[model samples]
Target: MGIDSTEFWIAVLQIIAIDIVLGGDNAVVIALACRRLPKEQRNRVIFWGVFGAIAIRITLIFFALSLLAMPYLKIVGAVLLLWIGVKLLQPEPEGQGHEIAASTSLIAAIKTIIIADAVMSLDNVIAIAGAAKDSMGLVVFGLVVSVPIIVWGSKLVLRLMERFPLVIIVGAGLLGWIAGGMTVTDVITREWVNDNASYLRWVMPVCMAVTVVSIGKWMAARARIKPAAMIDLADNANK
Candidate 1:
């Protein structure tokens, strides 16, 4: 699709809108994963993360429709998302901050972002493919345009996370919510759910959101206390 064509412009708008609507969760994942990185590494992680995610999406758009419909795929994704959400909330082990090398941390953050984005991008890839249709040009252009938007969003979210730790909980809950929704819609479960438990489509998401938040917060609290407990034990030992 050429730039001058009306259809091309419409498709561009559609693709951009789709990303803006469905990409917030991705931004959250990127921010949460990179939250612990050094200031210098933050931008590097975000840029590479987005680059990796977009690359995955470009590949996925080809099979996006069939991919999500596969049995057990979304269930597996849901599990991964739950694990990621919990891990993101967990406090890094005490004193490991400076111990781990920067390259390792940066690579790990980028890995997390890419994996989560690839898994959670079911709707996004399909939506963009639908919008862009047969025109690879439109797809590339739209995603390229969205790069800055997603980056800005990730930065904004990172700032919020710094200012308010609660945003981490909220972001984790969002992942859980998406996981729950994704689970029920999986091809294997959709029919049974539609026939017998229609409400689960909505109920499951809320339940999962609460479950993630509760478990994550509890684990975070426990991790926060471990250092104090260890110090007390050392003092008692010395005495």
Candidate 2:
């Protein structure tokens, strides 16, 4: 199906959301794996690792596109994306940043990131494929564009994350929007939308988005509390 400008924007936004949601775990893996290198080599390791991850992710997206074309897969993909969006709102455990070890090899660092990226990116692959549907070119284009943005944007993104957590909020909202589109595109819902015409064509997507974002924000709030709760425990110990 030919995509209009509105659909194009939606697809791009969904791809970005998928990238952000799945990117954190990859970043952590990269940081930890590369931390063992010398300061001079750290950048090199990161550069190589990111390059590998981008290549692998693009390949994986092609696989995702193929899988998404199977009958009934879009429904499954929609559900999966919804779950992923919800999961992003959950709390992640904090760890001490890894330290540099002289023995850390570049090959090992790249391996760590690639393996972790593959494992962590299932949601991203499914979610983006679902949002992009049969647009193989767009899917590929989105990944090509996003890879550098993620690599170079890391420092800026971190600063923004720290200073304005709302960026994450908006990202989650965008995921919710993607989830909405996925749900309505499901085979079962597509028939219903066709029959109803007026109600479901708009209502289903809007409702799905609202539900996801509302639940996601609530989950995020709960996640935000964990750190504060830990801080309180530390303060009490000091007292």
Clashing pairs in 1: none
Provide the TM-score for each candidate, comma-separated. Answer: 0.57, 0.75
Clashes of each: 0, 1
Off by over 4 Å in 1: 1-50, 60-65, 97-99, 104-146, 149-155, 225-239
Ten consecutive residues with minimal summed lDDT in candidate 2?
Answer: 94-103
Model 2 scores a TM of: 0.75
Question: Tens-digit lDDT track for model 2 on 46-144?
Answer: 877777677777778877777766667777776666666676666663443245343378777766677766765666667667667568767775676
* Model 2, CA-based lDDT: 0.67
Q: lDDT per residue, candidate 1, 156-180, as tens digits?
A: 5556567887766765676667677
Evaluated at residue 217, the lDDT of candidate 1 is 86
Error of 1 at 148 (Å): 2.3
Top of the candidates by TM-score: 2
